[model samples]
Target: MAFKIGVYGSNIVESERALGLARELGQALAAHGCIVITGACSGMPYAVAKTAFEHGAEVWGFTPALNLDEHRRAYPQDDIGIYRRLIYVPPSYHDLFGLTPATAEQDWGARLKYRNVISTVNSDAGIIISGGWGTLNEFTNLIYEGKPIGILIGSGGLADELPVWYPRLRKKTASPVLFEGNPTRLLSLILQRLE
Candidate 1:
């Protein structure tokens, strides 16, 4: 089977450099025969999704949506320029076997957390571009869990110097989390690790 790479990032961007990096990272993953996995949202993740699809790579969207319609309506999946398929599951934490809902906000977060874990756990590795608090949480989860991860550095957002400041990343993450300046080379390395 092809290697699966869970892509972590946000649709929101802080600058042009960040967006450029995200696109390169996505293209690299697809070029190396690694399946691109995302939260099925937008921004960096979406950019990667498009590249993977365009390159004929198998793209999977592990969305937080309950169904296909919701994914299309609420997410940036209208045109599958890069992705091949979309899989929607409840993002609620209640789906975690035994969990009780506390409040409306908690319920919503649970759903996102639920899907995030599912996507990351199932992947052989991950790619973290620029992002915010949510991206950090996903990256941290994957690292502490001992998954091999790669970062497309210089993209700002989650890149440009992410691990330096985040102690948790240095502590739990198995460095050096493969950093690459070229997408193709980075993806090739990831594929080698997967094999």
Candidate 2:
């Protein structure tokens, strides 16, 4: 299987520079023959996934919703066609957790968090771009799973802040968390470390 690289970032990126970097990262992943994975949300992650897909790379997405209809209703802004495979939280899981459609909105936050965990755990490694609290949650999930991570330093948000926090957040795992401003070099470093 191609290396699955999970991308975590803001769902509402406003910076042109950060958006450009996300596009660059997507192109680089496609060039490297990596499968791009995201949370199936909008903004930076969607930008990366769309670019990667356009470049002939396989893209996978994990959605917080239980099915395609719910995914559309919950995330109407997200483009469904960008992903080669879009995985939804199984209905059995909802049944087990007693998460009915009526209660889905009330528990949306928890669903998104668990989706992050699922996506992060499935990835061979991850990259963080401009992001907020949700991105931090995904980053922590990667750290806990001992997956290698690449933080695009100039992308702003958590990407810029993570390096400063890394020392305090370092865990026992040898999994490397690299920070770089350039997407190509960062991806190269991540791929090398994976080897």
Candidate 3:
């Protein structure tokens, strides 16, 4: 089976530069014969998934909703056209009521974090695009789990900040988290590490 690469980032607060970079990354990963995995939300994930699909890569989404109706309600303006497979993770009672930070054992952000966990679990490596709290959460999860990651620097948001914080992180990974602003080179480096 093709290796799955998880694409995690912001659902909102996207810039043209970030979206374009995401497309390039997707295309590169697809060209390398890797399947793209995502949370199936909007912004960077959608942008990446679209280009990956166009490049003939199989895209998979781990959605938080149980069915189509719930998905539509959760992401009314988003598109799921690029996903070759959609895995639904039903919302738990905690997801509906809990308001704490996401942990490895529990659902957070109304099961959105749970979907992030599922995405990471299914992928061999991950690419972090411009994002906010959700992206940070996913990045932390990947690092804690010892999964290799690529952070797209210069894309704004968390991607730009990771390089600064990475050096200070007390917990380290032997598999380095590669950071590059240039999309082509970044993709090449990520594939090199993974392959």
Worst 10 residues of 2 by lDDT: 97-106
For model 2, how does the per-residue alpha-carbon lDDT over 1-195 read when each residue is reduced to its tens digit? 589999999998759999999899999999999999999998899998899988999999999888999889877887788888999877676666666656745677768977999999999999999899999999888888989999999998988988888889636875688999999999999999888
Instruction: Please give the lDDT score at residue 108 for candidate 3.
Output: 34
- TM values, all candidates: 0.83, 0.93, 0.87
Ranking by TM-score, best first? 2, 3, 1
Worst 10 residues of 3 by lDDT: 101-110
Q: Candidates ranked by lDDT, best first? A: 2, 3, 1
TM-score, predicted candidate 2 vs. hidden true structure: 0.93
In the range 106-156, model 1's lDDT, one tens digit per residue, is 755776777788889877888777777778778877877788777767666
In model 1, residue pairs whose N, Cα or C atoms come closer than 3 Å (at least 3 residues apart or on different chains), thus clashing, are 11-42, 11-43, 53-82, 91-111, 92-111, 93-110, 130-158, 131-158
| Clash count (model 2, backbone only) | 0
lDDT of all the models against the reference? 0.73, 0.89, 0.82
Which stretches in model 3 have alpha-carbon errors above 4 Å?
91-108
Model 2 spans with C-alpha error above 4 angstroms: 94-103
List candidate 1 segments past 4 Å from native.
Answer: 76-82, 90-97, 100-104, 166-176
Q: Candidate 2 local accuracy as lDDT?
A: 0.89
